[model samples]
Target chain A: MQKRNTEITVGMFVAAGIVAIFVLAMKVSNFTDFTDDAGYEVVAEFGNIGGLKVRSPVTMAGVRVGRVSNISLDGSTYNAKVTLSLYSQFNTLPTDTSASIFTAGLLGEQYIALEAGAEEEFLKNGDVLHLTQPALVLEQVIGQFLFSKAEGE
Target chain B: MIDFIRSLGRWGLDTLQRLGSGHLFLWYMVKGIPEVLLRFSLVIQQLQSVGVRSVMIILVSGLFVGMVLGLQGYNTLVDFGAEESLGVLVSLSLVRELGPVVSALLFAGRAGSALTAEIGLMKSTEQLSGMEMMAVDPIRRIIAPRFVAGIISMPLLAAIFSAVGIFGGFIVGYGLLGVDDGAFWSQMQVKTDWYDDVLNGVIKSIVFGVVVTWIALFEGYDASPTSEGVGRATTRTVVHSAFAILGLDFVLTALMFGEI
Candidate 1:
């Protein structure tokens, strides 16, 4: 009887551990920077998204200050419309702040990296940033390098 | 020259005879299908006994596999300055291939051979013949239960393996390895697709279960009606099941990924 009880308890513990791990995994995957009512929104338009998935970090000079909220298409222009949720404390983004999809390292995931521009005017919420660059596809870069090498040869 | 020709003829005859016998054995399996199905219900109960009860081992193994993958993957990626992509490698490798194949192989070794040996022993003792004489279909009674049990056990075991493995990775990578907790979580959420890897693992296990049970039951039923035959059958069941699993894994992977 004691053995049976011990077995059951062990099974329960394992089950609990599995559940906890799964919950933790879910929580980690959906990580966000927005604090309670303390974040602003901005919009950026891109020609191509490449592998820019939603919830990808929006970093400014290597510091993550926001995240991608939504990705849609402009019906008339056929451009990729990206909505970004910036932290409320980081409201001093210049009007000419350029948003570009950049990679961390070779063979790393793509992120929306923001480079602050030297402008006097501060950008407001929902204001669309002018300068934007799409993700640099590896294939294209490789192809260009190979083509240039061949031409030089 | 005459002696050499005679030896060659004899070898050809032997090969033909062996091939014919193998074909007849396959025919017997097909002909016994109705009986196999009727016996399958009872096999389901046996599988519950073997597969379901063995969940603890499967879970533990899965956890260990996941944890090791996490630790190793993180270390390798960190060296390359790409530690955050560990989720992609761990989840993809485990789900797409390792989870089902490893768990099924373990199940075959632990339970599959035992089932074959038990049934082979009963056959050697004429216990199966006694049932046949009493108008009882032995395939329905003995073979079906094991077959059903294997099919039921494999998928469940594979699922436990995948879940446990992922969790193990999390514990080792996050808790022990000290990967940025938030970064780890965010990477997994944004990158991992449960449907692609997890579902594929379960499906592969189901196919593996059927193949393992079929090979085991086939060897057990066809054993020579002797004590020695039971021992031979047990050995053959394990070896053949392992080979069949590996072959099927290759085939299934190719089919699933459209590699063909």
Candidate 2:
């Protein structure tokens, strides 16, 4: 009976440990929603992607549809080439869909926001988005405000 | 003055000798691991004593730590008007630093001391010598299973600590405070990377397990066969394990996160 009790308790302990790992992966992290095979990659180029990170979310109309998989400089165009891995369910995005960087809240993370255009074609793998807006730079906004004020004077 | 210098030299020599034997003890423990696996019941018995018994303390402490983090994090973050980030702050700290380090400390206090005392008492009672006289290698028959159980238990305990702590944070943040549930969980999911944070925490706990268990077992095995010696060895095990854990944590954190 003592041996049986030890076996039972040990078994329960191991089970509990596994469940804890499951909770960590599922609820506390983005692992389930961010698997590689569940998404298709598309490239978006911008003049500036200020504060944009690799794993930043790609959302359409405030709903997260994918994530930024890679960010690099486009050598020939000197633009920021960002590879977006959009979820497979959102494959029918218009070929002329516009992607813009938008900050969440007042001082929150930056994410790519997509606005669909009137295009019959759908964006496929290796498709480069042409209609893109760069991240808004706070310094530039302030400088422009000052310049316009001086011009008014 | 001459006697003082002679005693200093004696102390230094003793220290070096113990260090050498500690490494040798580690090697024998490793060499005995196969036998431990072959006679797996020994490991199960140790697992009950070492691992299963430690669960209640790990869970309770984990919850309390998480709750404290939640309350403290919420207070600090509310000042910046960034209370929505309470989840990120709570989860990151718990998973990255607090979970493994604090749980290991607790494990050292609770289980590590017990292990040292038990083994030390066994030595003082000459049970180990009796086994040796019976042609059984005490290192193989006794120590290895306990060592393996400790190694397995530490990571699981840390994981439980982190998980329970997160739940505790949620209780404070959402139930008590009024942080949006969606914001709390979504921000946590967005910020905490599985590979970087959770995996690294696991790695830290595993290393801590190996170090703490080795220290406890070695101190016990090397204890002089007397009551006072057993007591002193038990105390030394806790002190040595704690210092090794903290120092090793710094070195590991530097290696893991220093560059990036």
The estimated TM-scores of all candidates read: 0.64, 0.92
On the 0 to 100 scale, the lDDT of residue B160 in model 2 is 93
lDDT of 2 by residue, A43-151 (tens): 9999999999988999998998999999999899999999999998898999999999988876778999999988999999989899999999889999999999999
Tens digits of per-residue lDDT for model 1 on A29-142? Answer: 231222235487889999987888777789998998888889999998999999998887788999999999988667666789999999999888889998999888889989
* Runs with alpha carbons beyond 4 Å of true place in candidate 1: A1-106, A110-153, B1-44, B258-260
- Per-residue lDDT of B95-206 in model 2, one digit per residue for the tens? 8889889999988888888998899999999999999999999999989999999999898888899999999999999999999989999889989988878888889999
Writing each residue's lDDT as its tens digit, candidate 1 over B140-240 gives 66666566667766776776677678778888887887777666656666565444445566679889988777777777777787778888888888888
Global lDDT scores for all candidate models: 0.75, 0.91
Off by over 4 Å in 2: A35-38, A75-78, B1-16
DockQ score for model 1: 0.12
lDDT of 2 at B254: 89
Extract clashing residue pairs from model 2: none
The window of 10 residues in a row where model 1 chain B has the poorest summed lDDT is B190-199
